[model samples]
Target: MRVIVDHPGWTPASEPRRTVRTENSAWTATAGATLILNRVGEGRDQAPAVDTYSPMDLGGSIPENLRSALEEQGPVQRLRTADLWEALATAIIRQVIRADQARLMYHRFCDAHGAPLPEAGPSAFPRPETVLALDEDDFAGLGMAFKRRPLIAAAGAFIESGTKWAELPADVLVEEVQAVPRIGPWTAGATLADVTGDFSLYPYGDMAVRKWAAHASPDIDWPTDEGTFARWWRSFAATPEQLSALTVLTLALGGPRGQDQPPS
Candidate 1:
């Protein structure tokens, strides 16, 4: 898939619709801001009805100065989550399944049951119970682990418990998702970015973060902790605009995306 950060764009190897790349951002266990980009209404005869939230201002938004700086560039168009639960699920599937088959299954699920919204209406996110209605083999057929069931089940619990979709604070979201079986930093941040627009959720802990960091400073002795790596990012991102620019810079110049993610 192609990610156009700003002026320069990178054609990420894996299809984002199916497989999500943790390295696409800057941190492995980012602040739970996983930006989900969809083709808008241009894909699979189905369109999502959810609003696209920016990663910079999820649940507990960023500081005003930082948020303004990030917003200076206008907006980064992303997918509507409510319309494509299968695609979102596909991101997890990508982690579990083989590369060649992820996109294929993505299409299969959408083609078979995806429901498009009205021209001006909101999109759809499948209910956890509805998703769990599927047999275990259904998820396994996608070449991923059986965690899909639990993941969906958890979403149901979250909804049933009256969890506000937009009220999860960054720290709370991180703690909540971390305890899940397949959720690591990357997955958690990715989810946050997509749903809440938490811009600070960098790295999302993908391989690209390490690669870009290495490329940026081949001479420095690498530090192993998240704290050390983030220090490097703060250097380039003193301002929010710099952080936005850094997302573009890291992708094209191989610099660090934030704390853990590298350039793709």
Candidate 2:
């Protein structure tokens, strides 16, 4: 009955629960008959209900073939990150790296500079001001030399207009986030998807998505090229909402599972 979340910023907490720390709050979720969310702090109001979309959102409008493929994979839900900076930072760190490497680097970066929340195993991502204050040596010390400029650039941009940026719709948010140097379309799209739980904003051409889609439906002749694959994937959906469900369900087919051990 234990659940392990493989996403960055979340750490295994107790049995059957996962916990995360944001700048102003600590949150935990336990899976049972119903997924229960608890915020661990006084003075702060309860955690707000998070809106999520799933394959069911597409209803009967989903293509029969895609629906059959997804049904074999069971249910999947995309959970939005509680912190925008954390989502953006995770996307930035993930650029051009393997998912395992990105996960390690994210933990290292957070452990080094982020504020600690003992109750939550993982540290909260450092704030924009904190990231802006770090120098080349500081980043190099954590083996994040290549990420320094982009992280600093993003931090500066976030400081300037992040509040306004958070209010934007997913499509617009991707474009606005790309304004930061070294943050390309893929990174921006990933950030938008993570922060909004809107898979329509995901970079459909991403290798993970491409790989998982092919694996999830072997009978379909998926394109090998990224651009072509993205188009082919999109062609299966009749609407933006259906497209999102298709992408999310495919990812869930190969998504990470929790282990009995704690996060490394």
The candidate maximizing lDDT is 2
- Candidate 2 lDDT tens digits, 1-264: 112243554443333354444446777765443356777765374463344445565656434565776776555543457678877888888888766677678878878998776465556678889999999999999999999999999999988988898788777888888878898888887787776666788887777677766665567777888789888777777787777767777665564331111111
| Global local distance difference test of model 2 | 0.68
lDDT of 1 by residue, 30-147 (tens): 1113334333332343322223223342222333443343344333333322312232353454444443354454444433333334332112333455565666676677543455
**Each model's Cα RMSD:** 10.7, 4.5
Provide TM-scores for the models: 0.51, 0.84
Give the lowest summed-lDDT range of ten residues in model 1: 23-32
- Tell me how candidate 1 scores on lDDT: 0.40
Report the C-alpha displacement of residue 204, candidate 2, in angstroms. Answer: 1.3
Model 2 lDDT, residue 226, Cα: 73
